[model samples]
Target chain A: MKSAAIAPGDVTRYGLGLAAPLALVFAVFFIAPLAQLFYLSLHNDAVATVWGLGQYVKFLTDPFSLSVLGATLLLGAEVTLLCLVLGYPIAWLHQRAGHWLQTVIILIVLLPLLTSVVVRTFAWIVILGRQGIINSTLQSLGLISTPLRMLYTQGGLVVALAQVQMPLMVLPLITAIGRIDTNLADASASLGAGHWRTFFRVILPLSMPGIIAGCTLTYAAAITAFITQSLVGGGQMLFMPMYLYQQASTLQNWPFAAAISIIFLVAVLAIVALFSTLGRRARINGDAT
Target chain B: MMIDRRRLLTSALTLGAMHAFPGLSYADARPLVFATFTGSWEEAHKAVLVPAFRKASGDAPVVLDPMLSVDQIAKVNAAKSNPPIDVMLHDPGPALVAIGQDLVEPFPVENSAYYKDLIPEAQDPNGPAPFFQVVGLTYNPDTVKTPPTSWADLWNPDYKGRVGITNLNSTLGTGWLVEVARMHGGSEANVDAGFKALEALKPNLAAVAANPGALATLYQQGQIDISPGNFNAIQILKARGVPVEFVAPKEGAIAFKTTIHIVKNSPNKELAFKLIEAALSPEVQTTLTEPPYLIVPTNAKVAMTGEIAKVLAKDTDELKKKFVFQDWKTINQQRASWIEKFNRDIKI
Candidate 1:
């Protein structure tokens, strides 16, 4: 008993000592800069001579700014939802496929991750442009006379973002679904339950943790993806990342940009928190059953 | 000397620290760092200006740090006491901002050999412009047939859903807006008429590109047949066999002075001045104005020739008559709000 108690304490202390170097690095690089950013955001003016909460007030009070925030959040939710819907079936297929087929599926999912996001975004632009593959094909088939505009539209942005962030959703789900006992599904079906019922009761509830993790990853990435967002969405679509860039880089309004960043960070954190809370409740319900 | 573990670790850490904080090793007297614009400008300077500067300064060590104007400002502002950049190149809008922020030293005009040789517009005591970036209409010659002669041609009913533009984030976009406002009886102080003109341009609009660079890609993709484009950028695209043509609008092409300055408190002030001087020299300017580069020269002494003379001007007098220089001082003041308004209103 004495050894067991001492071992736990000793291991924790050793673990902390091992992590000390990284902690110091984090404090020096990340925390210090973040603190400075927070300090800078407190200023009222562009040059940051006057100190106040004016920057925050400017963002919060302005309806246009709030709409940009809302649109960005909505964009994340749309991309995440699309990813989950598309990824779930692939994860399920991955779970059921033969070994060779499983390798092929995994390759397809992981292929996009190998190439840079820029290459992928540019590929999307080519795919969606006027006189592009889709338009030419459609025109040849007599499906449409004029080419449809798709490149810079909201729909195109969502589709492009969904494809870009799909790996984040799929990878977590593959691991989560793979963790399930195969016999449980058989048992679920044998108990007078249909395939849909078994999936709902046996598979999805068990994969709650993965869903939450994937949603969190995809949501954060889809919103903060500056390059993909700007390239795919064009100049008119004002997202949080581009808004922040315009202020900080173009206007030289660092204080306002800092304030925008802080607000965006909090907003994203709150959504992640909500996802985890939902996961916790689902876990509790599963335990009760 | 026997190498021990502790001694080896100590020396490794010291080396690493020195690498991380370069100030520890070279406290002063680093090479002259010139922050030139990226892409073709970097290539042009690396080829022509650097060689000229080296020859003038008796082969002094110089480094070309290529970046955007705003990035250069941010970096110099961060280290005002010991600025990393000895020299900076800027567009008209950012030149005013850098000057306002007190980040640049006034040009020593009296000492310069070629300051007076520059056109009157390029001569600013804050920092003289060595080059001019002309903005005009770029179009697909194969599709448009007759070349676009005026900015008004962008809104032609026949070219519906074929015209593209960029938002007011870039110097190109903002300057174009001011010119449009001027066309519609508004000035730098008010752009309401410009906004009204844009509203009427909605039917013809195909894309509102993020920047001037993206506008080129749109042309390549055939997404837009015509748009307001930078002269040099269009040349690069045309060289790549993109079937594009640049024509100065009847209203006169917008001429943005690309200014060079010595960063305040730069360690290599003399070398910085030498680099700017080399940039201002007619020999270097004429070389940069040639094929592939196609940079418009600001020096009155550099005789125009090749593609620049054919398309832009044959001499300084014609160039002045054809080029429209907007008051960037007035434009910079209202730029932020205009960008905001664009963000709010410009949705097709």
Candidate 2:
């Protein structure tokens, strides 16, 4: 038998062939169910006997639904911003720390991810409860007369979500910041750029890709986090996931639930697309500089 | 008998496929799958009901697939012809939904030994209720001082920022809402009064818990002092030393029938019937009514004992007198709209 020469095109074809099984699985499992969901969303009623865009119309037309959508999107932004603010310092510290300290920082960053999300959220409940640590501490210190209501509040929810999703933010930032050349920052400093100026000009822009990546991961995770959202945010604080659950599971309104899912998917996709566009622009600007 | 590479690989793939998809190997004689509720219900059924079922059926192969009632409905609805679950347990609201959706088979009531034994409220042709989940005012006794005698106690300004509640996503929440509406002169069909009451309750509300489970957490954390709570849930908390006390208000505690139904087109229909029969039986019900479980029995013959007797009722007569059963058929009709309204209006 003659040995056949392998071309780059052949490698690509072989790669496609290897991906065929997974593609088939996705098509059958994920794509098929998603298609069914979309089809279900088109119906007017709960049973899905008649086909119409009534479900979408009902969601989009209703101010309540739109507000829920807005609140959910805003929640993701809040979480992302908090994660960025808190996580950037830790990621920076990780990069600058000694070998042992770097390992310690990484472990600390990753420790929350290791435990279950439910466990972490429950821990947050304990920490933010009426007679919880903060409340007791404040009361003992005579800081306040009444226990500050923290659990189930939006502010408390954001903080808990930020803590839970910190790893998702920090991991990407660490990798992105690590990718930046140390010599670039040193050269900027040598040129009489102050520490703050060096950071603002060199480090921040260079870390934009990481920031974008971290934000995207965190934003998606925080928004779609059903367990954390429900447990932390409470019932009255209706986020998209909880809203969708209330429709689908509680009311058994499949059509409406499907519509909510589709709308949420589209909204999240749009946000992710925006992030990618920003990342691309940042890259272009970085290259231009 | 030569194991060639292609043949070996093909055989290996076949074995792996069979392992991954066990239904391919045993589609005809799959064990009975009863989709009971998660947590305490799962524990009660596993300990008391399953044993009784096994004993009656001569140790028949059974699987306890614990899930929420709505989930069971969804699962069966998705696969009408070949349902994964043989049996399903539901709260009153989802029971109506399951029946309306045509996802469940009518209980063979005539053949059931305990169907006639069940109290009038528990007996349904569609699905016989094996258990009754009682909802009443639960309070932190240490903090509450005076035991609340009525639902109106929740509105008292004395307990400001110390009350908890769940949204309409749960059976407990919806049932409690209907009861609240009834207290405010609104029936099951109309809960506008309930909404008004909830609005009034905003001041006292410490945490509008996402679910009943979260309410328990609030009590444990001292986040809430008083709330409309499930009897069994409060018992579970009390057992764990949570200092929570359940009291049936003067208006009457809401009794939600925890209905059990055989799924449509279940392969193990006979076993499913046997299992449900076991669930409805007095012996199993009595055991479940005892300590740790504290599940209120629907079978009239089962002697009410322990915490259930003390907290809920002494017997079937008292139970009938004390427990207020709502027309869930009426409630289920506009439940979607009510939930939507709740989502819109309720904000702390």
Candidate 2 residue runs with Cα over 4 Å from true position: A1-24, B1-27
| Overall local distance difference test of candidate 2 | 0.91
Give the residue spans of candidate 1 off by over 4 A: A1-15, B1-28
TM-score of 1: 0.94
Q: How well is each residue in A1-289 modelled by candidate 2, as lDDT tens digits?
A: 1244544656888899999999999999999999999999999998899999999999999998999999999999999999999999999988888999999998998899899999999999999999999999999999999999999999999999999999999999999998888899999999999999999888998899899999999999999999999998999999999988988888888999999999999999999999999988876787687
**DockQ of each model against the real complex?**
0.63, 0.70
Q: Each candidate: how many clashes? A: 0, 0
Clashes of 2: 0
Tens-place lDDT per residue, model 1, B1-348, is 999999999999999999999878755479999999889999999999999999999999999999998899999999999899999999888888899999999889999999999999999998999999999999999999999899999989999988889988899999888888889999988889999999999999889988898878888888899999999999999899998999999899999999999999987888889999999999999998999999999999999998999889999999999999999888888889999999999999
Per-candidate chain B TM: 0.92, 0.91
Maximum-lDDT candidate:
1
Candidate 1 per-residue C-alpha lDDT over A65-147 given as tens digits, one digit per residue, 9 for 90 to 100: 99999999999999999999999999989999999999999999999999999999988888888877788889999999988
